[model samples]
Target chain A: MIKSNSTNSNIQQIKVAVDCIIFGFNDNKLELLLIKKKENPEKGKWSLIGGFVGFDEDLDEAANRILSDLSGLQDIYMEQIKTFGKVDRCSFDRIISSTYSAMILKSRYTEDKISKYNAQWFPITEVPDLIFDHNDMVDIAIKRMRRRVRNFPIAFNLLPPKFTLPQLQVLYEGILDEELDKRNFRRKVAQMKYLVRLDEKDMSESRRGAFLYRFDETLFENEQNFNL
Target chain B: MIKSNSTNSNIQQIKVAVDCIIFGFNDNKLELLLIKKKENPEKGKWSLIGGFVGFDEDLDEAANRILSDLSGLQDIYMEQIKTFGKVDRCSFDRIISSTYSAMILKSRYTEDKISKYNAQWFPITEVPDLIFDHNDMVDIAIKRMRRRVRNFPIAFNLLPPKFTLPQLQVLYEGILDEELDKRNFRRKVAQMKYLVRLDEKDMSESRRGAFLYRFDETLFENEQNFNL
Candidate 1:
């Protein structure tokens, strides 16, 4: 089973890396976490947090490890979005990067961990130019996230456990990058049987406080689509 | 700008390969193209048609190259469905494979080329236990293809340029592995303004032939969703 063919032996091996596009939602806006590169080639430049995969690690393992190292958190909701393998994508070396898009509760991360990695959260619309093909990666990740949010109840990952309907609407607008009609939006929300109304209300947005609701995971299990 | 970090230098490199899960439709059944391995650790076992990616080649390029070498056809409809890197998925060596799911018109491929590679088309449900983790790859590819067909008009890739409504419905049923109500299916097809009916009739199925239709690409370009 360890035998090698001529084709295998002659093929050159290339370094594989995993880059994480960590997304967070705050202040009615979608945000992205980017780190300032501390090494040469792209030193001081903003880039998606990434590193070479360990010899024994699987692609998903590598993605989770890299995200955990910078976030000081584990079990983050993440998925591999795509793999970018252009020969010169990385100017420093021929590294094939498998990129992942992660949704994390922004309030959970410790500030100390963020400072240690020189990480900063930029509002999705105002992100600075990133090094290498990291900008392209972010754009693609956002598009994937937008498409995913329409079909899955993944926005809960970016929201607090208890939130108002308006808050949920704002989050969807941020991800979709378009304002939705209020009546139409609420009509769609009413169809979702998985949103449990809580007794508590949030008073910060208006004098007439809006009731808070929690996403019921157990109920969602029986549901088919998150068409909102 | 070309400086490498110690982490990059210390990391191990692995061979990258591309495996194509080529799908086709024939006789109202979905089929998969698989080749019998000629050499070994698992010689004579059925496997996905694949090869080590050239050092200078992009991943998509490698997929197309591997597929064309076997089928002797270029410009096939292919997409990178997922990348499999379970560390030991391949027993022969430490290799990472980026898998692609491709849809090709079954009638277009020459029989000589298929025989040359010991390739055979098997009904998707009857696919044999393939070499390595190819079965898992095929399963993932099918799931991706199913999801894709829901929101995209990719089924056209598996059908001839000119086809009848019955033929199209049969292809859909084969891909979805489900029976559809003839009236309901036709109702949905009626909404697709892009399906242009021609004066030609296909009399192969019955004395009163079905009207032939062509998918109008230009009209589809302006339309948003392929809800069918």
Candidate 2:
């Protein structure tokens, strides 16, 4: 047991790391970006992109750096999920990690960056066994994301800037993992009033096509209490 | 910057501590349990009841132990709010602290135990200046508790085993920091249907008396999604 007394020289300083659970959406399915561990203790196993928190860096900075290094995306919508501090969570040392979850558009990542780290996008439902407690981190991240999407307008980070109503509904359905009646979903969207209809149309799905909509950042920022 | 390489001997281990923000409610106001620091390096200053996280102990266990030691309350409704890892947050060393928040009824703590540690309860609105980033910890704790009470049935933990609807409403008001319409609040409570009405009345507040209600844990457990 480490002593609370600050002057105790016998007290040990534990290593702290940050894990990023980056989520993306495409084809009506939720996806996670995972990489193969290239270091000792768990080399060649699937794992979350994580590294030790530098003594000079804040936890948030470490998360942003790791996310950018892995996905080549900057200013991503990231949240501090929680800290994982089990006594033996890491195999190599007594390391405590802070887990962060990020929602990014799947289209934002370029092929070159994805290949640079040998990172692959896998359907969240069929994620491969992860190294150490990475799997538990994913499970916790997913739960937090589900709850977050239900309460806030933050999930729009998972979609493109301009999207059709159907596309938006599909993203929500994928996240909630439940089917929504189209009429009821549209009604709820109409009531939100923070999504403005664009004059553009997405003709990819059908001949009639679907009208496009974009988030009203001004309104969202003004109305802090807006919820779906 | 600290190197991520595990073999780097120059990497320094940082000190970590756990601070507990224990909240209790009575007299329609939110109160916080704060103690005068008893150790050196800012001893006798107002501070959160905190201690070092033992190498062999889990973070949650450390939080529980600290809370019990300070308040003489065990198994309280405590949760990990977040980790504050700012480099200069501590004065003695490079210390990162994980802050936890706990809710308990004010009536539960005996006066003798509180005086044992020179602890005093202050309304959260007018908390005295605390050492280190403890004030920031309180602000974050309040925000998380507000969101938590709105989503979970855990708010009942702040009240006695038998409470009146008005008492429940007061608890919500204290947490949300807002006034709710009486008719609308009762209607929402009626819809929840998880509060079992008891055949008792509390005449302390009024001669007509308000009926007492007890939470039905069975019903709440059976219902998966209950929201406000």
Candidate 3:
């Protein structure tokens, strides 16, 4: 029957919430934006920028809203990692979290407008104790990010318009959680041949200035279709 | 404000449903199992076997429900295809569908059980007009099925414990929707050395039936790691 069983019935009950795991590449370190929840149940504890999804809003839109509200960055790479529907996962209610991961270059958000709600960036390696179920979300996000980084040049989205090869390698190393051999890594990237060596050099890193490189999105997209 | 702006906001106002786009490889025909909807807003129309997901139910469980309900088969090769969240997609009060796809060898379901639900196996090349956004769902499901079949040994789960060389080839052609050069395909598969050739033959398709082939999951997994 199409009749409503309602929430009070003996049947199972579910509450849905949206959690965002934002990964940023900045200062040769991989960081994730985390908000301190000043609300009840887990007050003053670090958590993913999250809220209960509205009945009328699409999950994708809700993900965007959360990203914009907290970080002021948009049009970033975002994907649904998975849905966590464990019944007893939430203590206050039966919240099933739909997790999303968005990327932003730390340089882009350096002047981020922080709201009264305390927001801070913590290196993924040095994250603080997060409130209920958020740590699980971040863990999954990292796993997904690592897999995508291997199959595609998705890390470029989380970078500045102009960056040195060393900086690019550092970002990949941070996301992949491994040391990439400089010679082999650059050789492999050169094989793709989608990056344009810019005239400028970022002189901030060391004594010898490094030549900056900017990726050609159109060319990079075409190269992606090459299946190599 | 933990409290939502609206009172009835957090409640899942619209029904959340799941649909299974079941694909069966039989002979050389790629088939889909479609049932006549018993309930409206789209009643009596040929559509995917679908039902409302119970609260606190895992997506995999709900997918299994649709499979067993339609085909009397459990532990089939099922996967979450995608979630369709277009507003007003369903004619009723805003229903969001999370679709799953199952691959099954057509030999499993008996003709009697298939006829019980007024179900018929239609060749994917000649699928009839479906109700709701089901046609779109099937299209996406087929794409996902093809992608999985190539990388993962998911096609093996659909077949029996033993299958002939022709059977494996036919499975690939049907799912991929393309013709394969037999000698080349066999050579490539042999190069992988994941499949074991059995002495036994089906002796069904011809006077001299081809030798059966079974893939070694452990071997394929090891190869997968290396290939990546």
Candidate 4:
């Protein structure tokens, strides 16, 4: 082993924090949850909902605590994508932020809870300049979500229980940031056994109405591989 | 914004460290580089090469520093896969370890440098019990490498500059942990435009020598996906 010249006492202890990029799908568009900072060091600027790591809590626990505190939701689909630890990334302190990408159904969150926390969902295309390295975090999260949605059925987390085929296609288009062919998209969706077609129809968009489908969680658990 | 009850001064700061799972390929088998701990706290046990994050450097810089310190090689393919921050993951201190997965060509490093740090390459199947959560880190790195190898030409980082088709097949098999059909694998290789065949042949393995090939980095950059 290489002889160590530094000990634990000499090494600097830095503050560790977790930031969440909560993504939602509504109005056939992808959105991100952001809060306006209330304190100094870039106050009033938009930022991802975040908090410092508690002494007794694990990193994932801290993330869950923060997410649940803001949205009043539990067991959200979340994953830690990357950790940002540049020396000057934070203006006030040399803190390391573990960034998590999460998806939650917009309808699942109560409007009162969101307003109480001063949080609002901004469409991904219209996301304004964020504080510190937050803009970079959002970009990374979106790229990860795009890659993940192709292989896994996690995109259902952002949609309601039952949704139209057009709604599903629009959600994929929003996440992929490209227009897909209608026939080819439907052909691919037709092969997925986990997406079950229901007798119900959604008449919100057109008079003819589109058939509603719900992602079967049990079947997805057994079949695996969304492969969209 | 949520009211901040925890200030930076009151929060318990923890030690942040980076551990590297350095993988290499030799004799058609995947191997890991490990060093025996020489000091107290699980001394004399095999562990991943790691060091504490310096006050002045970024996380990636710290990972590169530790990796180069042992292997005497720079610019190796490396990426941060995950951060392990369980409350009791470390026996001695409350340490938050940011684990990175790295790959290096075994032929590039001299044996003298490896022995100077008491490091040895252990086959993936033969890795001994590691201290703390190092074993779990190795498992996660392998899964990530498998997923990445299918989509990227990063597996070239483990092979020699000039290699045979059989050698490449064996390397892929080792990474994917499965035997692929020869005809199917060859057909897939034929579709990759960036694997340039050379005039040389490697005769060490068979009476009928196989032709050598090298990866075209420029073509790969333009083509983007390996899609193996």
* Count of backbone collisions within predicted model 1: 0
CAPRI rating of model 4: acceptable
Error of 3 at A69 (Å): 2.9
Q: What is each candidate's DockQ, to 2 decimals?
A: 0.33, 0.32, 0.20, 0.28
Candidate 1 wrong stretches, greater than 4 Å: A1-12, A159-165, A186-228, B1-12, B159-167, B182-228
**Fnat, one value per model:** 0.41, 0.32, 0.14, 0.35
Q: Native-vs-model 1 lDDT?
A: 0.80
Q: Which lDDT tens digits does candidate 2 get at residues B38-150? A: 77888889999888887767788888888788767677757788998887777656678888888777886687877776688999888999999999999999978876676
For model 1, the docking class works out as acceptable
Span of 10 residues, lowest total lDDT, candidate 1 chain B: B1-10
Which tens-of-lDDT digit does each residue in A114-225 have in candidate 3?
A: 4434778888898887877678888878876776676467777667788888878888877776888888788767755778998887888777899999888888667543
Query: Which pairs of residues collide in candidate 3?
Result: none
TM-score top scorer: 2
Q: Give the Å error, residue A63, model 2.
A: 1.9
Which regions of candidate 4 deviate over 4 angstroms?
A1-12, A157-167, A183-228, B1-11, B159-165, B186-228
Model 3 residue B168 lDDT score = 78
Q: Lowest summed lDDT over 10 consecutive residues: which window, candidate 3 chain A?
A: A1-10
Is candidate 1 or 2 superior in lDDT?
A: 1
Tens-place lDDT digits, model 4, residues B1-228:
222223433344677889989987666678899988888877899999888887678888998998788656568767899998887787666778899887766766676878777688999999999999999999999978886776567888677799998988888888776888888789778866899999989999898899999999999766542210
Candidate 1 displacement at residue B27 in angstroms: 1.8
Q: What value does the lDDT take at residue A35 in candidate 4?
A: 89
